[model samples]
Target: MSDVVLREPAHRVSPRAVPYWRLSAAIGDAIVAIAAVVAYVVVPGMPGWTIVLVLLVVAAAVAHVVLMPRIRYRVHRWEVTDTAVHTRSGWIGRESRIAPISRVQTVDSRQGALMRPFGLASITVTTASAAGPITVDCLDADTAREVVARLTAITAATEDDAT
Candidate 1:
């Protein structure tokens, strides 16, 4: 028999974002809550709507409690090496990307109602091609902005160097 093990790279930086489940649960809860309210007002006397609304609320609540805390994530790292910016994402199943310092077109950040309470945000790095937009959701708002700013600066510096 043989045993094998793997370790995280020594230089890897932990992402400054909340778990995906947390975001998902919050979104689920919000939608369910709104639906519940609508059901109550529009179909309060109907047993089926009431039961469905209650079930949704219970399911969302359970997911929020049981699953959100168990999920994990890591933000993509921006190496900003001489020629490229490396962006990686994943927890159990990992996906990685590298953009030549010149290829990054824009960086954007977003915060939703659910994320607002947790003081979290998302940063999306866009390339010229539509298919290449790399989005890292669940980052802290300020941290997301800082990361974008740094990438922008790096992109600009690389452009200057190229010229």
Candidate 2:
């Protein structure tokens, strides 16, 4: 191999992914909002601040549901190569990881109910290390499958050398 290192460009998931993220975030926030509303309604003589607090909570949740997906999409990226799997993800704290194909023990592709509607899936690449699996989320379904297949083949080739 040449001394020059290879790097992959960053990429975002499908644009349709925004709705899936929004819906999931909204659903969780709605559950919390509903419980808060029930408490306000059922409790006798609740403090006036409770009303203000609930409204602020809901506004913040709405803002998150509307905004976080775009941020997440922008930050997440993955690439699979014969030598390694590279990923960068997360918003609050960004993480970049590179797992050599020789270290990969398994690869999987999974889709949730929300992801299925948008034809999105997530790819997981597992290594023997304690750091846990690396995941590429919100990929196009076909692309996720292809990545899994390619990673599997690449890892398999290294098994003999590892032994």
Each candidate's lDDT (Cα)? Answer: 0.62, 0.82
Residue 16 Cα positional deviation in candidate 2, in Å, after optimal superposition: 2.2
Instruction: Report the lDDT tens digits of candidate 1 across residue range 36-106.
Output: 76777686467665767677776778666455444444334334454655656665466666656677777
What is the C-alpha lDDT profile of model 2 across 101-128, one tens digit per residue?
Answer: 8888778889998899899999888887
TM-score of candidate 1 on Cα atoms, chains taken together: 0.55
The runs of at least 3 residues in candidate 1 whose Cα sits more than 4 Å from the true structure, single-residue gaps closed, are 1-20, 26-65, 74-83, 90-93, 160-163
CA RMSD for every model?
6.3, 3.2
lDDT for model 1, on a 0 to 1 scale? 0.62
Candidate 2 local lDDT, residue 117? 84
